[model samples]
Target: MADKQLMTYEVGEQMNLMALLKNVTVRVAKNGKQYLDLTFEDQSGEISGKFWDASAADIDRFQAGRVVRLAGKRETYQGSPQVRIAGLRLANADEPHQPGDFVVHAPMKASDMEEQINQVVFEITNQVWNRIVRFLLAKHRKAFFSYPAAKHNHHAFEGGLAFHTLSILRLAHSVVQQYSSIDAPLLYAGAILHDLGKVIELSGPVSTQYTVEGNLLGHISIVDGEIVSACNELKFDLNSENVVLLRHMILAHHGLMEYGSPVRPRLLEAEVLHQLDELDASIMMMTTAVEKTSPGEFGERLFAMDGRSFYRPNEPQAGGPAVK
Candidate 1:
C-alpha cells in the first residue's frame, strides 16, 4: 500500500503529499514515451511534478481538479524545483480533505469582505458614480466575492477578487490622508470598480481560466462597456464629465498601454488609483513569493517583477515568529 502520511517537500527527501492536481498534461519525453506532467498544490504552495513513462491507466487516473496523494522525491533540474513521482493515487472518499482544502484562500472571509465593501460603496459621495457602482456591484455580487483576481500570480485564491479591491481601498484611504488634494470619493469609486470586470474575465475560483469574453475583450474593456451599459440603463449621460473620468480610471489602472490600459491616467485621482493598485498588487505578489521561500534564501523569480527573485531575509521581525 502507498504511504498515507504526507510530508513536506524538500530536495533529497521523499515527499508524501496530499495535493490538488492543479494542472495536468500528457506530454512526450525525449525518448518519445508519454509522461504525466502535473502541478501539485497544497495549503503551503505548489510545485511541478512528473510521472514518467505514464501508462494508459495512469493517464486515466490523474486529472486536473482532482485530489490525489503523491509519493515523490523532490529534486532540482536546471535550478527549478520538481518532483519525480514514484507513486501516486486518487484520494479516497474517506480521506480527511477534498479539492477545496487545497486551493488557497484570501485572509479575509467573503462575507466580511462583502460587508466592508458595501460600506465603502456608500462612502462614494458622487451620486452618479455611486449609483453606477451600486448597480454593477449588485449585478456581480456573487462572482465579485467568489472569483480570484488572476488565474495565477498575486491573490489568485478564493475571494481574492474582492479581497484585492478591498486592499486597494485600504491603500486609497491612506493615500487620501497623505495627500489632501486627492479626491476621496473619486479615488474610492475608482478603487471599487477597477477590477470588477474580472468577474466576467475569469471563469471562477477553481481551476481559474479566462472566459471567452475575457480573452476577446479583456477586463478593462469589459468593465468600461459595463459602465456604458449602466449609464444607459440608469439614464445617465455616458459622455458626461464625471462618467468619462470614472471610465478613465478603469481604463488607465494598468498605468500603461503595453500593460493593457487603453489610456493613461489623465486625472489626479486616476493617477493615484493607478499607483495604489500597483502598490497593493506588487506587495501581494512579493509577499506570496516570500512566504513560499526558505528563510535566508531567495525565492523563485517573479515574472511580474521583471524576473527578479526577492531575497527572503533571514532575520526575524521584532515581534513575529521567525521565518523558518
Candidate 2:
C-alpha cells in the first residue's frame, strides 16, 4: 500500500516521511539546550517539528527549502498537528524527490490558467492599451503565473495571482454584458493589469512573503509606477486618456483610501473594477472559511471580514422563488 500523505498522519502514528524542510529556527529550551523548530511541507499540507537538543551541526545540515527524510511521530499541540522528530537527514540524490511534489498551488493547472489569461489579453481591442498590456504580461508572465495573490488570505497559493486575475476578468466579462454602457476594452485591461505589481511586491511562490517594496509601496502603488514606466518605454503619450484611465484603475482598485487605494475610484471603469475586485476577494475568503470549518459550526474569526466567523450550514438551501 502507498504511504499516507503528511496531512493523513494521525496522532501517535510513527511516520517515515520525506518532505521539504520549509523553515527552521533555533531556540533555547528551559534546560538551556538549543533545539531546532522546523516546518515540513508536502503538497498535501505542512506540519511543525521539534528536534530537541539539536546541535549547531544539525542546523547546518538541514537548512530551509531542502528536502529531508524524517522519522517522527505525530502529536497535537494547541489543536494543531506537530511532529516529534526522532531522526532526520538531508534527502540523498538517490531519493525519489521532486520539488513540485512538495508545493501547494492553485487547484487549476498553471498552463491552463496562463492560456485563459492570454485569451483575455487577446480580447483587448484598443491598440495602445493592447500593446501596453501585452508587453507587461509578456515581461512578467513567469512570476505572474507562479506567485500567490497574497502571502495569506484569499488566493494565497501558487498560481494564485493568475487565478485571481483570471477570475476577475471573467467577472468583468459578465458585468460588461449586463451593463453595455461600460467600456469593454478598458474594463478588460483594468481586470488584467489590476494586480500586476504583485509580481515585484511578493518574494516568490514558495514560502510567500512581502518584499520591502510590498510592505512600503504595496501592489497598488507598485503597479501604478509600472504603468508609467511601461508607457514611457513604449513612447505612448503620458497624458493619453487610455493610459491615465488604466493607471487610475490600478491605483484605485482597493476602493477606499483606508484599504490602500491611493485615490478613490473616479471613473466608471475604475469603480466597476473596484467593486468586482472586492466581490471576487470576498467570495473566495468566505468560501475558504466555510470549507475549512466543520459542518454546523462557525469558522474562525476573519480579520479581513471585520472579525466575524462564518457559519457552515449543514445542508444547502433549496431554490428560492423564481423571478416573475
Candidate 3:
C-alpha cells in the first residue's frame, strides 16, 4: 500500500493526525539518552516511530491505550515504512476522538457475535459436554467475548477470541455434516472452549500483554487446569470417559508437543479440533494480509506463517478469491 493511504492518514500527505498509542516503551540509546519506542494505530493499521530524548513525564503520558495528536513524516528505513516523529502530545478531553475511536475491532458486533455463538452452543448435544461448556462460558463470559486470542497473531483485535472460536465452530459444523462418523457434539464443544483459557492468559484487549501465569504456564496448561477444576466443582467424575475425552480435545488442540500440546491427539474428534483450529487462524491471518497487499505484489512477511508473504493478484484469479 502507498504510504499516503497508510493506515490512519485520511489525507495523502504527512500532517498532524490523531492516532492511538498502541504501544510505548522506554529504551536507552547508545549515547545513554532515554528514548521512547512508540507504536501508533488507528482503525486502519499501525505505524512505529521513535521519540528520542524522552522525559519521564513523556513516558508516563504517552502510554499504550491513549490517543495522541502527532505530526509525523512517513519515511522508509531498511526497506520498511516508518513514521519520523516531529511532535506529539496526548489528545485533550475536548478533542472529538478518544482511545476507542482509533482501536481496531472485530468486524462483527459483540452482541451479534455472542448471539450467533450461542446458537452454536445448541448444537453441542452431549449432556456432559453441554454442561461444562455452558458453565465455563458463563464463568468467563465477558473476557471470552472481549479478549483477543493472542497478544499478536491471527485475530488479535477486540472480540477476536470469540470471533476466532465462532469461525472454527462454523468450519467444524460443515466438517461434521460431511463426515457423519465425526462426533458433532464433541467437535462443537471443543471449538467453543478451545481458546477460552485466553481470557486468563492474555490481559484485556487494549495494549494486550501476557500475565505472569500466562508466561510461565501458558494458555494450554491454564485451560487444562480450568477443565479439571470445572469437573471437580460440577461433581462430575473426573475420571469418567466423557471428561477425559473433553479434556483431550483442549489438551491436544495444539496438535504436537513442540506446538504446546501435552499429548498428541489419539482420538478422531481431537484430531479434527486441532486441524480446524489451525485452519481458522490461518485463514484470518491470510485474509488480513491479502487485504493490505497491493495488486501484483507480495505483502509483508508473516512471522506466524514462517516468514512467508502472499502474492496479491492484479486481476481476478481463476481458482481462488481475489484480494479486496
Candidate 4:
C-alpha cells in the first residue's frame, strides 16, 4: 500500500491520494459552495482537507468513517493543506483500514494505558472504594475502550479519559504520601472517582462532544450526586467528612470556579487531587501539542485546549553565538 502517513501535503506536491485507506472520515461541507471534507490519517498523523466541487454521486458512495481515495489538487489554505477533489470512491470491503489512520491509534496505544489503570485498581485495599472502582470500570468498559478524553483536547483518543484519570490519581496518591496526617486511602479513592462523571459528560467513539447534561450539570455535579446516591444504596459507612472530602475533590477537580469547579479545594486531600489533576491535564496538552508539529515549527492554533500556538523548538541560548 502507498504510504498514507504523509497526510499533510503541500500544493503542487505530487502524491497519490487514496481514500480507500483505513481510518478516514469523509464529510460534506458546503462552504460558499460544495466541498468534500476529507479527514484522512496514517501512523504519523491525521489531516483534514477540503475537496471543492465534489460531485453528489461521489458523496453518495461513502458514509462517515469510511475509507476512500481522492484524485485531485492539493492546495494551502491559510497555512493548512486542502484537497480539491476530482475523483473519490470507496475501497473494497476486503481492504483493511490502517489502525494508524485514526486518531485513536495515533501516538499512544490504548491497551498499555488501560493496563496501567488496571494496575492502579488492583492496589486499592478499601472494599468500598474497590467496589465502586469495579462498577465504573465494568460499566464504561466499552465506551472507555473506544472513547477519547475530549472531543478535540488533550488525550482525546480511545480509552484516553480513563487513562488520563488513572494517571492523575496515581500521581496524587504519590504526592500525598509525604503528608502523614492525611488519609491516603480516602485521597486515593477521591482521585479515582474524581472524574467518573465524565462518562456521562462526554459522548464517546466517533466524537467526544459534550452532552446536554455535561454542558449543564457538568462532571463535578454529576459525579458527586452519583457517588452520594450509590453510597446511600450500598449502605456504605460513608462518613459525612469523608463524603464531603471526596465530593470536594470532584467539585474542585477543575481547580477554579470559573473553569467549572464548584469550589476551590479546601481539604488537604482534595487540594492535592485538584493540583495533580491540573498538572497531568496541562502537561498532556502541552506535550501532545508540541509533539504534533515539526521541529522548529509553530503548532497550529489549538482552540479546544490551549488558546495560543506553541513553538516546537527549544529557545536559543541568550549569550550563545548565532548559528552560521
In lDDT terms, which candidate is top? 1
lDDT of 4 by residue, 1-324 (tens): 654434556556654554433232444454554555555544444555655565676556555556656566665453344555556666656664443344454244667666777777776676677666666667666666556566556666666777777778668667766677776776777777777777788875443468999899987898888777777767766675545656676788777888888798787777777778778877787777676555556766666454677777754568984333
Q: How close is candidate 1 to the true structure, as a TM-score?
A: 0.89
Question: Of the pair 1 and 3, which is ahead by TM-score?
Answer: 1
TM-score of 3: 0.89
Local error of candidate 1 at residue 242 (angstroms): 1.5
* lDDT: worst 10-residue window of model 1: 1-10
What lDDT is obtained when candidate 2 is compared to the true structure? 0.84
lDDT, each prediction: 0.86, 0.84, 0.84, 0.64
State which candidate, 2 or 3, has the greater TM-score.
3
Model 2 stretches with alpha carbons more than 4 Å out: 10-16, 23-39, 47-63, 70-89, 96-98, 315-324
Best TM-score goes to which candidate? 1
Candidate 4: RMSD to truth: 4.8
The full ranking of all candidates by TM-score, starting with the best, is 1, 3, 2, 4
Candidate 4: regions farther than 4 A off? 6-12, 15-38, 53-63, 71-87, 97-103, 106-115, 122-127, 177-182, 211-216, 237-239, 304-306, 314-324
Between candidates 1 and 2, name the one with more favorable lDDT.
1
Model 3 alpha-carbon drift over 4 Å, by segment: 1-12, 28-34, 75-81, 315-324
User: Which has the higher TM-score value, candidate number 2 or candidate number 4?
Assistant: 2
TM-score against native, each model: 0.89, 0.81, 0.89, 0.75
Residue 47 in model 1: lDDT: 80
Per-model root-mean-square deviation over C-alphas: 3.2, 5.0, 3.9, 4.8
Residue-wise C-alpha lDDT for candidate 2, range 248-272, written one tens digit per residue: 8888889899999889999999999
